[model samples]
Target: MSRILAFIFRRRGHGRGWHWTDIATWIWLIGGTILMFGPALWLVASSFKGPAQLAEFPPTLLPYVQQTAMVEGYDAPLPLYTTTQEDGSTKVLAEIRRIGVNSQMVDPGNPGERINVNIADRSPVREIGLATGNYVEPLVKNNFLRFLWNSVFVTVMATLITLFTNSMAAFALSKYRFRGRDGVMLLIVATLMVPLSVILVPLYSVVNAMGLLNSLWGVILPTVATPTGVFLLRQYMLTIPDELLEAARMDHASEWQIYWRIVLPLAAPALAVLAIFSVVWRWNDFLWPLIVLSQREHYTLQVGLNTYAGELNVQWHYILAMTVVTMIPVILVFLFLQRFITTGIAGAGIK
Candidate 1:
């Protein structure tokens, strides 16, 4: 009976241990979710607040308070008369002051009338109401739409060019065996070690000579050939079964046909992954675009966002609003494409 009791006690302890492990995993998941999403939640909440509520001490997260002040009636500047006191001192005053709903005139019989005044409803101060205009103003004032268009243009064109060139080079390195093929691959890979800054001056000179400075092409042309993209795609392509290519060749498929039909579709997942990276990189790119394009019209979203940071004073609220706006596109792209990345990596590995 003592032995039986001891075994039962041990089994109970093992059950508790498993229960604790399950609880730990749940806690970890909850904590990670909060850490990842807390700032974004705060930003979205803050975007709805009015300026005063946002600055309130002991800071209120919700915009529930509404305060209003009365000014002298609506004649331009609302006339305030000066009264000469007995000793030649003069006083100026607004006609009305309020405590609760009741309001009293400063001087019972002032000539000017009082009007209920409403301050322009500025952007949401606290985390309560939506201030649509705060988000809207930056887009209109800064030519954000044009900047967006330029960013899209550059990203798409550059990504397409990068994909085409890199894939072609990668296909050559992967499929063809010739004298010095391995040496050529090594040399191409070696270029990846060179820092982009080292070539900026020479690249700038080439763009300037071509008269492409300040042009979208200048931003697109230099990055059309990325060694990283080539290297990554080549590794992926090597995993493709040679038997498939040989079968296509037996059917009298040309090299281009084999690449177009057989290789490209099988390589879709890897290409999608590359495309997402290319788009995000080009979209967020600032320094290169700043160096290449001097014109404001050609500025990308990243460059345009910098205008909010002035030499003398930074408009923190406006800058924050614009920043929130700018992140939307990147977030959307990532959300849409993130599903492909893991699958692409797995597919590439299988090949």
Candidate 2:
């Protein structure tokens, strides 16, 4: 451990000792790490706490519950507490019941007699405990698996369609020089400034006219053609030499063959970047899915998560637990494809 710490703090370039820049860099990194991961850690911790623990003021860092003991002649376990006696010594006692500011406690060893103590004179004995039920109960009671499947289907289908359609649009816009092509590209790019909220009603009308309401296809089809994706892929495809396509054409290759064999292979990094973006966007989208799918059976994960909130109460434990579950896929996708992001974005602007 000491050697590892020494190596970590070691100065680069044969410096004799630590420098001020090194100290600042380490401080900045540590602070950044805390800022990034602290809320996630807190969410995980809070997910394992029961309602009582969650409702406590100035929440604890770890899940905690009052310790309980099975006292003699009691049918159920009783909560334990440490009470300060008249002689200023403390004794562990099991609580029977509380009335007003006083509590009736019993010695676990001698359960026949009850001792009265002021609530202020005693504090409940608590130990770290995880409420696994927060994770289990929701799965058992709700249609969690169906919701997960719907989300997965939407994300996968939408990503594939986004990649295919965007790449095709990009191929044409970049390689082909038809009249009004610049105007077409400008119109597509300009759509980025138009917020989704502005088009929701018209989009919904189109989906409704097509009889796609309450259908997963409605969610997947409407969002597959994204201007951001077209822009990204087109910019990247522009960097590919036109000579490559001409060479393929000279070898008796069709346009589709050249696109499939030459262009896509070279633009893999950009496609990967677009794929990651599409997956995240489709998976986390809530409003469109909520508006389109009225039936509970067709609800996606984001829409399904809202069911935890009732008119009078919100089941935060279930919400937090399921939220953690929902994040696992997005996190895994990012970790898997994160390597291509820098390369793809940089290469896109080279031309």
Candidate 3:
């Protein structure tokens, strides 16, 4: 009886006893994953799609491979159909559009022997040529590789600056007690409520005053003093016990040494989390970069990608292809630092 009962409840300890709520949780997770990843998958797929395949009747997920579908008529694009020629011999005729929905066969080399084929009795064989020019053409024509390099430079520099400044500020705020420190902290947190748009004009004026206009330095400098980053680092740093710092101090470690050696090493997890956020923020940054830099050579990947658009038509294939390329760094950074984010957030938030 015990064996029988055990066999019946074999999964009891495996997944918290497998309630209906577990099924609901799984449904929600699968649904959320699809929702988040579907559009990104579509964008990558669309990058490889040909122009005709973009509007194909039955939507295709994979890129349409260039294949020759038979062309029915003449070299000049005509529909093919079976028609009886002069000797009652059947010849295939390629059709040309006529008035209304009607179509007619082009006159053969001899205009006098016009093939007036029936509207319903033609079996047209195919001859459609396929082209896959989008992916390679844009990169070659638009100097996209240079833009990619510029984007990489900007993202790396901005993330490094933000990490250094934010972490230093966080260490001071979290580890030290000073007169008016609470007020300074309050002021920094208060900046979070103010949107960047509200101060754009002033910020630009400041950048211009420093003679950083139309430079990468202009774009990188303004973003370094992020209030949110300071707050996040402070929260994470607060979780590090003071006893560790005191021991270092007893060894005659200077304030800067204590911060550089002791605090930073212990705060690696939080720094990793911050680095991920900083990379994503700087990588996707477009507006400021656009406003600061005007020269084509200096343009980041996002701004340079705008050159593909025109008043007449937008080249979606180029846009999609470049967008996928631009996203690679952010995805890689997240993957590298993802393990630290959850743990750091929990430690910082709870402490």
Candidate 4:
């Protein structure tokens, strides 16, 4: 036991060459990767499962495999009704008889009363299933595709608006010094500490007053200005040398030209990072979209997913598949912009 522990924890060779720490590090990495991605892989796989396969106590990972279950009331094969032949003759159709327990580990005591059945009459077995219809059924039955389109449009528009508004505010605060500038920034940043729940009623009233209820514009308009985005871009903008802006000014560059040509190009990294966050936020935004878009046809994907939830039994199969579908865009966005995330956040301090 002592040696085993030493092997796992202690250095193996001289001078830190291939120490146990390296092994431990690899082990940790592998374990963490599995822990993160295992459930995702499982959800994708489970979407393909048939009803019987899904209810298995310890669920199987691989789809499209035959499951030999020891069904209740069945020690031996039970006979199904006979099938008619071409000449109108009848033949007995029977289930496959098990000699002993099938899947003893899964069901040690699940077997039941023995009945006789013919081996020759048993039909050929089939795979578990792919169940592709789970994806299609939701789109067809609940107008899920429309909701997906709504989410895409809202998220895109809102993120674009957020980038423009936040970056403009940030550029002004960072580059152009003015009276009460610090006070204005402080006030805006302070809003970060205020909980959204506290202002929900007042904010909703304001939206309602604008006659924007039940519209996607209502959802997009409320979230266009994000404090975090402002702060991040402001800090990032501060890193830009004023000498460059001054040089451009000496060359007779207009304020708008300097902002458009100089500031925006340099701030692309921070914007990429902000875009990723904004997309994720608006994509998963359920509560606001639900409240604003009361009509079913105008629902976002997240809201439409709620259609799967019932008062009693939830549609786990469709939910699982749709959940996978929901995650794909976010994953793609992250994968595309992940290189900028660390640099953006690190350079653009939270303040």
Best by TM-score: 2
1-351 per-residue lDDT for model 1 (tens digits): 999955644434346544666657767988999998888867766665555556667755544433222443534332233334456675443334444543333332454654332222112111234655667776787677788799889999999998988888888899889899989888986887775688889888999999999999989888778877887788889999999999999999999999989988888867878898788778888888989988889888778778656536665555667677778877887688766655755654421
Give candidate 2's error at residue 177 in angstroms: 3.2
Estimate every model's Cα lDDT from 0 to 1. 0.71, 0.89, 0.75, 0.76
- Please count the clashing residue pairs in each candidate, in the order shown: 9, 0, 8, 0
> Candidate 4: misplaced stretches above 4 Å?
1-27, 65-124, 346-351
Ranking by lDDT: 2, 4, 3, 1
lDDT of 1: 0.71
Could you give the C-alpha RMSD of every candidate to the true structure, in order shown? 9.5, 4.2, 7.3, 9.4
Query: Which residue segments of model 1 deviate by more than 4 Å?
Result: 1-32, 50-59, 62-127, 342-351
The residue pairs in collision within model 2 are none
Q: Which candidate, 2 or 3, would have the higher TM-score against the true structure?
A: 2
Worst 10 residues of 4 by lDDT: 101-110
Per residue, candidate 2 scores C-alpha lDDT tens digits across 63-116 of 987899999889999999999999999999999999999999999989999999
Tell me each candidate's TM-score.
0.72, 0.78, 0.72, 0.75
- lDDT tens digits by residue: candidate 3, 204-255: 8898999998788898888878887888878878999999889988999999
Q: Which 10 consecutive positions of candidate 3 have the poorest summed lDDT? A: 65-74
**Candidate that scores best on lDDT:** 2
